[model samples]
Target chain A: MTQKTLRKGNEALAEGAIRAGARFFAGYPITPQNEVPEYMAAHMADNGGAFVQAESEVAAINMVYGAAATGTRSMTSSSSPGISLKQEGITYLASADLPCLIVNVMRGGPGLGSISGAQGDYFQATRGGGNGDYHIIVLAPNSVEELGNFPKLGFDLAEKYRMPCMILADGILGQMMESMAFNFDPVDPNKIGKFDWAVDIHKNGRKKSKVFSYKGDNLIADVTERAKRYGLIEKTEARYEARNCEGADVILVAYGLSSRACLEAVSKAEEKGLKVGLFRPITLWPFPSKALKEVSQKAKGILVVEQSLGQLVQDVKLAVGDSVPVGLNAYPAGGQPDGEQILTAAKSLLTGKKEGLFDLQTHAEGFTYECKRDLSLGVQGDRKEVK
Target chain B: MSTILAKKPSTLTDLPMHYCPGCGHGIVHRLLAETFEELNIADRVIGVAPVGCAVFADDYFTCDTVQGAHGRGPAIATGVKRSKPGAIVFSYQGDGDLASIGMAEIVHAAVRSENITVIFINNAIYGMTGGQMAPTTLVGQVATTAPKGRDPKMQGWPINMCEMLSQITGSKYLARVAVDTPQNVLKAKACIKKAFENQVNNVGFSMVEVISQCPTNWHASVEQALEFVRTKMIPQYPLGVFKDEGAK
Candidate 1:
């Protein structure tokens, strides 16, 4: 039976890796996610497993790449600045299609911005951080429970797709304690079969093999095939969670801790007689655009709430097209958006008013005072038409 | 017969070696392959080769082998050892790969007490990439990068690997040996065997730094390389067991 225990996101990640049959961990410590390496060191020490506190993040990532090449389950964890140092190895792993798990407990940063919880790395995690026409399956967990469960899923997806999978979380989710289930099914490595290319000992009559990332065939054909594979993955694996989306007039799109806050706001807005909902994406790379489009059909607007400057909002806008208005509830670096504030914005949109919502692209679009007055007059004339 | 010239044992198949004639790497490779044969651990041994002179080591050693990027052998070996706890994993690294680029990898792997063996070959220069001076090159040693002889004021001192590695508690066995003479080759073989045995017994990190000769890079004859090893390398990196608690 699955049992629950008090655990933080980092501990859950450690347990999940163990459950997924990860036998090796090589990482250097970084704040907010140091517990992962520490736990692996202690646990692997007693089990005759391997754990190495590499001298730097660069060394740790290359180590993971090497281990993964041998068809073994291995992992590493770090925060923003440290993760940046690992881009070189990550690109190589992606090019090789090596299977491994990487956990990033994000803190504020363009460059050492802050140690506090921040969702500032959404683009880097989703897009190309390293140099390559490749993508990693990025899983963003919204709760302590998901933090525990996603590592196993990440490992399975890594092996299944032959690609790296990331558990993109923030410092708060990593450090906060909550009760969670710890039991997991045992992994049978043969289920995935021994990688024929793995550099393992061969007995008599076995032919030598190679495991490299070089794509040396017809250049265009090789890149074209890789692109086709990525397209297939995009079609099949993109996943997200939605709540109260049925017949809702307004949707809130967010990820990680911000999604949790958006869920609370959506519930409060519902109590105050506004049709509100939430869309929390699980896989950020194979983004849940289809699901967002389906939700947008019934919604009048989408409020993209996030801890960063609403990076995902652009994605939502792209998904929904111009069929519905896409709003923003941005909470810049230091402050967090309150549920009351979100509720008020929902009320304004429900009543056909659009005066005080945050418009991240307003000045960039060159909206002057004259434009606002003209828009307000138009809205008044539309009200007269309704009367 | 010494382990150095023991007829290429079953552990190391006679698959025409790809190394150049008079290359000391061949001697070091034979010593390790024969050690695996002597210990009867060939079936369960895994070798990690770096991107240097020993890149094709798998063609020589009969055991399972994987290649790592430059300076990443130790980390890869640590991962292999961790995942396959019942198997023996060792990284065969050269002076440039181990002492220079991979310095951080080897150091931290030893510090963590990873239960893997490392056979570090210090030839005082980078042989594969055309004889650049290595971090282990002695103060007065000359190489392509150190044309004026390694200047102590400009370049750093020759790294004493055995002495430095002995500081790590994670290492159960650490030693520096050489292959200049018949007697010294024997001692070096014994040290390598012990390091491998330590891993078999799960005794933690083990390493043997072999002070080797590089005739091509050092601009000397095969006999002269041996002579240089004895007259120059040995005095700097003495042939002895620096640290060993393996039998305990």
Candidate 2:
């Protein structure tokens, strides 16, 4: 357990979950996150688990619903498009108060956008993508080590709160290989205590358990009671990593993969004698608002950097409202920003320059796309001349 | 004659069901509970209820139950069975629930040879949603959607689930039964029992499609609905065991 071996982000998270006592996994194939299910199919049986190659993403998540209802530690993994397909089951699990883990190795999208890594699903993950007033625990891990570590933490949080938990990594984080090891020893389901509410086998005069989401008459009471749990989670579970925000004039706020870029940018800012700090939220749902609010007090400018077009900035703006001048540097829809690009944005925030800002208005003025396709392929010629 | 004739199965709960008068669902529910009790697997039985009129089917069973989204019973049942292989899981579904919106799930569940039982009630109309045309509606059946009495050229044919599922290699057992007469009801019970028995014996993917009558949806009296099943519905959906791959 102490040894660290090189592993892909997707594969490491899969093994991490197996160690965390995820005894069931059901998922349909999708880009970037295929390794998670593939790894599960190979190793889950060896560790006393079930792996289902479901017909579709819809079927896969419902399988997770079924397994979780029976008090088994269940999970499913998918990319952006597949995750969208799982919203129905996710909302059902949330409504029924079933605990399970969902991993979204994100790709570009509005439709089947691209297979490249993007943080376009920030709103989807943090803002309850399903049709309900519910919040799932969202853990945004930045590195391979965090990816390997978050599944155990995610599973524990999901069970403790009796809600769905998500590990929101992107295509880059999933496919890129790095050295990381699981932090916890492998868990045994036999040693675990059974949940009283689980709809498993009935035995010896015990009242049979019923797991259903249709509260009909008590729908109001059920949802309202669950809202109290969400409120408690919001207050206590907000997590983030702060770096050098003591006396900075500019601070960069980001999460997941984008945070890694901001971390390097912070050091570059200090070397250039530019006062800059970084606040990376690990729990995107809870948003680390209070901590960011405290960190923003000493700063004059807050630069929100993200892979999506100004999505994370909205949360940052809400967290640090009216106190600081907020700016956005969005590298949206498969756009991966490097440390230099973030540092340039940081430098512009310190000065009165608009060069580094990539907001909708600024970026919109830079390009005028023409709707034209190359029509050269339609020309007919002799077979020899065609070459 | 004073001796106990037919008490309800112990697996059935005391909770009252919200079914329509003369509905076939009541009969099917009784047969399932009896199957669980007779097989001595009631303690390990888990029922997945669908989202039609029988959405509250879980409440009627003393066994552990789960109610999921409409047409997702098979996927959920597959999950429950795979997680606890020793547990006997069944998905109770309606015609519209199994054949229409949930076609992909039911078909794939069979294709995977999953060890589960499906109690399919084909009443030819969507009863809970107020008599809409279902995927199993007869060619000339009058429904809210098929007001012109279901033009075959436009609405297509009623899907024969047993006949269709019988061709699939993974489908181990398939039967179409009815609850029209006393004799047919007993026959239907035998088929329902066989479907559950298949799961208990680890025989993969068994389903018993009951050709039921919906007096409310059919706009007929209970007697007329029963007569219609014998005269009209059964001729199209016919009764008898279609396939049985026992113990395999």
Candidate 3:
């Protein structure tokens, strides 16, 4: 492992993709994720690769579909609204079981959300944004180092399952700098397994292959098989990092940047004579629920701290069950709560003096910058305001 | 006496196509198949099927095929061609998939001058979606969306992709051909062959837009549909190569 001087999560992801043999990148320049395509534009030529700043997110993902069908390692990166445009193509990518990487440096949204950091796309990322009964392997990184390794793992899993894999990160992760070591196993194009169903011209007496999503008549049956695959993934791919849970009274569950804040909050609470622990999910989709279920038994309560309005909190309640009380420090839209607020919440929870049960709260004043882009509601259905 | 329909062209299979009766798509498919065969690059050709009438084109083409999102055939084809430099890539698209939803894809693909082929079938109206108005719908054409007849003020002027694409320097072989008659079918085949040859030689973006008859959408007899392509559609969408390899 060669230690590189400090690199941002976006840069680390780019370097990791290159080391893992990503040769094709298609994306429109969106905030936070601009570095990914920028890096590819400069370096792709030298590596005999391709980089295209597509006209729209829709075009970019279709380009990914094309490249992946040819059995090449390809990727695309964007922020929230842009990722929304890509859901259609991503869904098709999932249906085709094409292996590619999609990096989403999430920002605020139900629509054209801000460009600033927010974990609002948590449900979209982990649940497979596209309309399908399928799921992408969603990996969330709490640190820059994990960002570097997670992409390699994403590609490996994508190839392993013959599906698209997403590195679900946030704007903060994309921008923050940290010292990280770059480690990757070289992928030989020859060693990579070719799906005979992929669309590649056969040259050496090989059978012809076709790649398509028209699994007609039996669409439901096909979707059911995809769900079963997700079941297996849920059973074995749960990943999380536990700290100070030996005899904890409260387990603070968080992911991405919020998880980092929760970690600090745990330490701060320990200093205040409160027994709290941190449960950070690295794989947000195959959500380390089993581990959380086991940990929930020993704890008095579980506080779900996330940057979204009670999204992952529901998952926590489902896993931990009604045996323990669950509290939510929910932040809606672009409001990213900080360590100070989280520490206060942790302290209150330990002392049985916590404020409100599942309070639907917005981010406390003045911790984040609003994105300049229009944060219009982009949901397909009618928007009802959450009070 | 045994009569064969030209051995099903080397690039296409003998399996009966799923196209409606008298649909010009089958003719265009045959022409493309023959073109690939003539170039002796059938095995090295990869085709992208679009979401409209020709969505099941993969089943027709003996070559490797991939289905793209509606109108995304060109972008997908670009990916295949660029990835496998030695291979020939083409997208078979209908009016809805090519002129409307996928407009950005084909236009951008041409602007980028990707070394690929795009076979655009224009029949004036959207045939697969219950005769809806397409971007290529004529000035007075009537479709489900344009019940009052396509008004230039309400519905924009029909998009002539050949003329539009010809302006892009990236396009090397751009042509608007018709497949309404046997004579036109032969001409269309030649045009498609040249486009494929351009890709084999790494000559930039090439396209063959075939003015086809949509009997079902036009609500005309099979013979009348052919007449419409020859009389009305051709006068508006004239047959000729708009851009040649020399320009690129």
Candidate 4:
């Protein structure tokens, strides 16, 4: 029997990385994902691993790049804003074809919007946030159990393809506690096989291998090869989950925390004798476009639900095309869409009543930053208040 | 039979270097190659090259090497050293790569006392970008951006990395040297060897800053460049050990 333990999502992911043979972790602190580096700092040494609280997100990602080039399993984690700072290094990692695990336990963003959960990074993760024509394998986990299991899967996929892989979660999933089973055997870094392309000592009389990003005259050829590899990954690794799509009037599309809300809305719609189903994308990058298209063809309409304004709805439109009308219901950043709201939107779409898209710009009246009036006052005010 | 006075170090490959005539990078590369041969660490050493004129350094070094983004070599070196503690790792960077864009990385690596060696080449100008100003460009020195000699009031004073890094408690060794003269080249080699030795002994973070010359960027002859290093650069960045906790 597998051992079961209740753990926070962030802690389980860190432990999962260790069990996957990740021996190097470097990260900077950020909300929703701080527990990852904090847990690694406390336990990594005990597992014969090294952990570093890097000076900045830029340095942390570069550190992971170095370790990964040496054939060591390495990882880094951050929230949305911190992950933005890591884009340069991520692009370099992709260009060099280095394997590593990157986790973005997303928070509200567009510039440090809030410390709460948000799925606003759907486009940033699925489409390339980093420059260049490259794609990272992106995995989305709706539950804590999947969060614990996905890091190992991510590492395996990254190494197998010689590419970086990302685990995209949100503050809700990262902070929530749930009972999860640790079924797989822990990996030993020492027992791992050698990489022919790694930058280790050439004791076997082989030529020293240079792990550099510069392609020189082979730039076109190199990128073409990467694109071919991406095609293979898309064909082999696209994953998704579907519920109650048989004879449904409408299908709801969501992922991560939003998927959980969709499940509840599906049950409520079913209780009212409305034919509604759910389509949750497990891999956001190699997006389950085929699965979504197949299910959307059977439904009368599709409702895309999310925490952010309307990021995932764009992808839904691309996948299903004009076969059926795709509607969107978006809660504000830092707020989750409840079952009632999703049900109402689904019912409205099914009845041919199109609800307007949620506009974050108009709704952000109270959330804007303002300079404190007291700080603008000169020394006439109390010195303590001046600050 | 005549005794051979000198031969090329085995640590250096046959690839022709990309540095301009009289550039200090060539001399520094030679010293590094000689040190690696003398210490018998060439086979196990892994070098991190910066995104500057020396970006092609992997072609010149016989050992395994990785090219890092501009100003990120130290962080990369820290990762390589930590992952494979047995492998000798070093990062080679230039003025703009280290003092300007990479300042935070080097400072934090020193604070963490990462067991790695850093070879910092301070030429006082951005060589690859064709004579642009650098953070280490001496006051009153003219660069492409500072066509009128740099004014401390406008461009800020040149940074002395050896002095600043010495203040960090985790730095086990810090030294500033130049390769303009033959004697100074020997001293620079010795300083580099000691920095690498500190990492091998697991002492702590170590670095050697080499005050170098860039004739092409300076728009000066090779002789004038050497003279400029002695007269102008030395006054601002004195050649000596700034800190050596390992010695104590």
Candidate 5:
């Protein structure tokens, strides 16, 4: 049996990157994810890696871009707003066909909502938040073990596809401590073969190499070629974990920390003589849609559980596409759903009660009270009172 | 056979540059190419090209080049150089790139004293974007964005990179030169060589700001552009070694 040691999720992920031969790391301080850069600063240099606490998230991502061009495994991590700052660099990295890891330790947002964990960044992560037609492979880790182990998997997929890979976890997973053992041997990049297109010392009489994203004339052709890879990835890489999904009355769809609640709900639903299934997507971008469609075939209805109000439900709807009734159990703005809460939502799905189950619309409708306008204030600059 | 007095640097490719006539980029590129040949570090040299006029510098120089988004050359160069200490990394930037959008990157790279060389081309206008005001655009100079001719109160003062960077404790060498006259061109090349030599010795951060000419953007003919560089631009950005820790 492998010995497990207690480690914070953020530290585990950082150590995972180091063990996976990520030789370059650049990051800035942001809540929940601050431990990531802290761990890198402490351990990266001793492990023969370069760690930079960049002046900003924008600079950090660009540094990753430069390191990636040299065929070094590079990474940067931040929360929502910081991740937003990195989007420009992320698009450039994808355009230049550079592989690197980007970790988004999600926090409440629309903008600086809170430092507490939230799943509000689902659309941003899966939809390629940057401006351009590109998709980065996104992984959702539910456990501290997966958080510690996902870097190797993320790096492999990124290098194989020659694009960026993101590990999307909320603040809860980042702060929580768990006993997890690394599943892979420590990597030594010195022994790895070099990438031919990498910008490095010209050895063996190789011609000068250029790594650039400015494809002036060949932009369309390059995008079309990249789309083919996206299609292939969609066909090839979609992983999920399913329980009692063969033929259940209701199926619960969730990911990351939210999935853990769904898993517990599934087990409890079994004890209650209700056949509820849980389908948790591990790979969020190549989002296990086909597998989901297969598992949800026999289910009468589907309930999407997530920390956000409706972000994950969008992908869930797209996957099932009205073949079955889809419902949402939402907790927006840094709210976490417990197993009991999820189980009640699952029961509501089975009973066909749309009251508290699909309450997002109801809540929106509840906010329809007329705004009390001050007559004295009038309409801003066009004040009614003659001064 | 006639004895050849001079030839093009080996590292400079035969490809014709797309720079406008009377532009200083051609001269500066040649100077860097010559430095690479002299130092015999062409194979190990990693050149970072920014999003300005010199974006196609990868094609001009026979080196491993990484061209990235605007104003990020220094950060990228730091990444490349730190990953492989044996590699000679140089981030080549224009006024708009280094001074404006990428100000923090350049300042922080200098602050950290990353062992790299910086080749800054200061022409006072955004070249690739076509005659816009740059961070180094002189007060009272007419730019497309500043049609009123760079009012000091409205627009901020032009940045002198060498003099500004000289104050940075981490910077080892900071020189500002020009390629307008034949003598100054030679002097610029020597300054450029010294910057690269500092990197070769792995001492600290070194930057050589070349006061370049942009005829098209300056709305001047070749002769007028060179004259503007010599008279108008040189006075505002005085040529000198602002700081040289090695000399001390």
Candidate 6:
């Protein structure tokens, strides 16, 4: 029987991991995601599972690496700075073709920026943060309901692809409370098909299997094989949500927390006789580029709204190409853009009033200009330019 | 009919090791193989190879093995042990890999009392990286980095891992042993066996710090290296059990 309950996003993510047959969880303390480990530490033992509040984020991720190699569904969660520390182990997991779940309940930052909600880690999540020709399957969930469901999806994708799958949630979604349902049957960890290559005692006299990332003399062949797997994943799994995108004048592209605001903005813009629709990417990697390209043919302009300065705008540009103009309405570092703000930006983008707004590359250029312009003046010039 | 006095353990594969001539890793590897065989856990044992000289350890062990990033062997072994508690897991690390870069991992693994065994090879120098200084490098020891004998003022004192780990309550067994002499080699094997036994019993974290000779790194002959272990290394890293919570 399915059960619905009001739950925080971090707690829902942890519960979803448990239901997905993740028998092992190792994580350290971090903001917005602290509830994840706290919940796991309390409930994991009841389900014949193990939980370790690891000494550090590095230890926690490597612990996941170890458990995953044994063919167990294992996981770890952290915020931005902590996720940075886990990159080495994540790369190792990718190299070894070990499956595991990693959740980044992202807080603001290039450093320890803030404890507030931000999608600043889009590049780090979608693109490879670690040193390797590898990509982690990245799933970005906007609501608590999706948070309650995506861990199972993330684990399945990770196991199917033999790579780490990331649940990239921001601080708002992590801390917000919403009603969620557990509709699917919980999987049995033991019954999740045996991995022939796992390190186990039940090999039954066959050659002992090893799990390692070293390519030695076969580096080129090894990387090519990995790239082929990624290609297959892209073909099979590019997920997104398109709302009222057909026959719309403007399409607002966003993900995670920003996507929620964009959805509300779509409705507000429509009510005001302006035609705007929302395109929310559920899987940040294997991005719904094809869908965006199709939607771009119908829409006159694309406005990308995000918590960071302008990370997702680049992807929007790539998806739309030179077919339509793409502008960014970004709330830099920890600030949340409201529905009205997004609606105004969408209208401005449609009217081509891009004087104060930013595009794909100009956002960075704008920041550089602000830095130089501020230094040119003796005093702290203007706060508007900084934002 | 020939009576076999000593034969290679079945746990050891036929592949030739890459250890330099007279390096202590070969002896340590043989000891681990023999221990696995004698304990009757050879087939079920999974080993973690460090990124130092033993990086290719997966080729030598008949049992399943994984290579950990430099200094991450214990963290990796912790994951392996927790996931498959029925399987016997161990990590083999060098001084630079363990006492230096991996200090945090080993310390916390001990604090958590993870039920696994660690075979720490403390040769006092980075062997694979061409004789660089290690955390366990003896005071006044000369290396590429410390050409003028290591100064206590410039570099800190040698880290005593077993003694440091003994203070942690989670560690069930801790020992420091040498493989310099024939009799000492036998003792070192016994120490290693007990450490693995503790893990088999699911006691807690157990570690055997082997005071091994690195002839190439020490820039000496095998005999001179053995003498160095006897005269120099032994005094700083005395051979004995530091802790044994599992002892009767």
Chain A TM-score relative to the true structure, per candidate: 0.89, 0.92, 0.89, 0.90, 0.92, 0.93
TM-score of the second chain in each model?
Answer: 0.95, 0.97, 0.95, 0.98, 0.98, 0.98
Q: Write the per-residue lDDT of candidate 3 for residues B98-216, one digit (tens) a residue.
A: 88899898889988988888889999988777899999998898999999889999988998999998888888888999877788888888888888888888888889998988888
Model 3 lDDT at residue A192: 65
Off by over 4 Å in 6: A359-387
Q: Name the top TM-score candidate.
A: 6
lDDT per residue (tens digit) for residues B53-77 in model 5: 9999889988999999899999999
lDDT score at residue A40, model 3, on the 0-100 scale: 88
For model 1 the local lDDT of residue A137 reads 89
Cα interface RMSD of each candidate: 2.8, 0.7, 1.0, 0.8, 0.7, 1.1
User: Which model is ahead, 4 or 5, in terms of lDDT?
Assistant: 5
How high is the CA lDDT of each candidate model? 0.79, 0.88, 0.82, 0.88, 0.89, 0.87
Residue A347 shift from truth in candidate 6, angstroms: 1.4
TM-score winner between 1 and 2, please give it: 2
> Top DockQ: which candidate number?
5
Ranking 4 against 5 by TM-score, winner: 5
C-alpha DockQ of every model = 0.30, 0.83, 0.75, 0.76, 0.84, 0.74
Candidate 6 C-alpha lDDT tens digits along A216-277 = 89889988999999998887799999998888898889999888988788878867998888
User: Poorest 10 consecutive residues of model 6 chain A by lDDT?
Assistant: A372-381
Q: Which residue pairs clash in candidate 6?
A: none
Clash count per candidate: 1, 0, 1, 0, 0, 0
Model 6, residue B226: distance off in Å is 1.4
Model 3 stretches with alpha carbons more than 4 Å out: A350-387, B1-5, B246-248
Colliding residue pairs in candidate 5? none
Q: What is the TM-score of candidate 6?
A: 0.96
In the range A1-387, model 5's lDDT, one tens digit per residue, is 236999999999999988889999999999989999999999999988899999899999999999999999999999999999999999999999999999999999989889999899999999999988999999999988899999999999999999999999989999999999999988898876788889998877698889999999999999999999999999999989998888788898989998887888888887888888889999999989999988898799888888876788878888988798887777777777777777676777678554336443333344322222222211111112222
Residue range B136-230, candidate 6, lDDT tens digits: 99999999999997889999899999999999999889999988888988999999999999988888999999999999989999999999999
